[model samples]
Target chain A: EPEVTQTPSHQVTQMGQEVILRCVPISNHLYFYWYRQILGQKVEFLVSFYNNEISEKSEIFDDQFSVERPDGSNFTLKIRSTKLEDSAMYFCASRGDTEFFHFGNGTRLTVT
Target chain B: AQSVTQLDSHVSVSEGTPVLLRCNYSSSYSPSLFWYVQHPNKGLQLLLKYTSAATLVKGINGFEAEFKKSETSFHLTKPSAHMSDAAEYFCVVSGPTGFQKLVFGTGTRLLVSP
Candidate 1:
């Protein structure tokens, strides 16, 4: 089965540095999403993308966060300036018209 | 607005015993419900989903869920628990007509005791 794939399984960055988390969604999937889970916390939605544009975003997805589909296969999330609170497991997911979603093994971001 | 609520933050069950994880949802329209499991340091795995199809939906790993509209609940159940079943489970809900954003519940952590 085709699955979503993310790069940099784990990352460690300085508090003020910028980082880009990359994902290659399932081939032929139209919708893409990003979600994060703080240690010991529920997974929280960050943003959703379709047609190379953001469909919706949560409060956590502030100005510091931006998503781009720079290429046909790559969906990237960029944090302008990383904060300590930005440290979490970030998961990229994709789904077709159906409700079932395929998630990539998350990228663990650690900012110190 | 749609949301999911997991009644229990943690559940402990013995190996070979039945497993139940209670979940309730609030949605203004017909919703798609799902159950996902996550092992340590891993990503979320879709166990099952209910999209106005059969009320009883079966998923991987011998897990299943019943969608009860009257009760506004989609509870996951398993016939027998295993040590591998010990993980964090999340209840998710999404409206059919909206932006297709999934709302996740505070997860329920299942611990299998031998």
Candidate 2:
């Protein structure tokens, strides 16, 4: 089956550096989303995108965070200034008309 | 708002034995419930989902979940546990409307032993 794919399975960056996590959602999917799971914590929603604009975002998605669909296929989450608390496994998901969301393996971001 | 609670952090079952993972949900309206499994280094896979259609929802890999509105629960069950069933299970909930953001439970780690 076709699936969502994420690049740079693991990323390590300095605390003040900028980092971008990339995802290629299923080709035909419409809605795109980003969620994060801190170690030992519940998965938290970051943002949702449709039609190249953000539909909704959580409080966790603050000024430092931004999402872009630079190309029709690539969805990216960029952090302007990484913080230690930003370290987590970031999952990208997309769904078609169906309610089910298909997720990528996830990008493990380690801010040090 | 919608939320899901997975009762157990971990559950262990022997091969050929039944497997049960408890989950409860809180939703302001009729919620869409789901169970997803994540194996090591793998992406989240939808095991099953409960919309308004049927109370009993059957999923892949011999897994099923029952939606009990009164109990506010959607617990996952399997008649027989297999070694391959070991993984992290997440109970998820979404709003009644179409395609809402999914709220996930902390998750239950299933360990199937020989």
Best by DockQ: 1
Candidate 2 lDDT, B29-107, residue by residue in tens:
9989999998887778999999899999999999999999999999999999999999999999987655489999999
Query: Clashes in model 2: which pairs?
Result: none
**lDDT (tens digit, per residue) of candidate 1 on B13-109:** 9999999999999998999999999998888998989988899999999999999999999999999999999999999998775459788999999
Off by over 4 Å in 1: none
Interface RMSD of each: 0.9, 1.2
lDDT of 1 at A73: 94
DockQ of each: 0.84, 0.76
The CAPRI quality class of candidate 2 comes to: medium
Off by over 4 Å in 2: none
Error of 2 at B79 (Å): 0.9
Whole-model lDDT per candidate: 0.94, 0.94
- If you superpose only chain B onto the true chain B, what TM-score does each candidate give? 0.97, 0.97
Fraction of native Cα contacts reproduced by each candidate: 0.84, 0.74
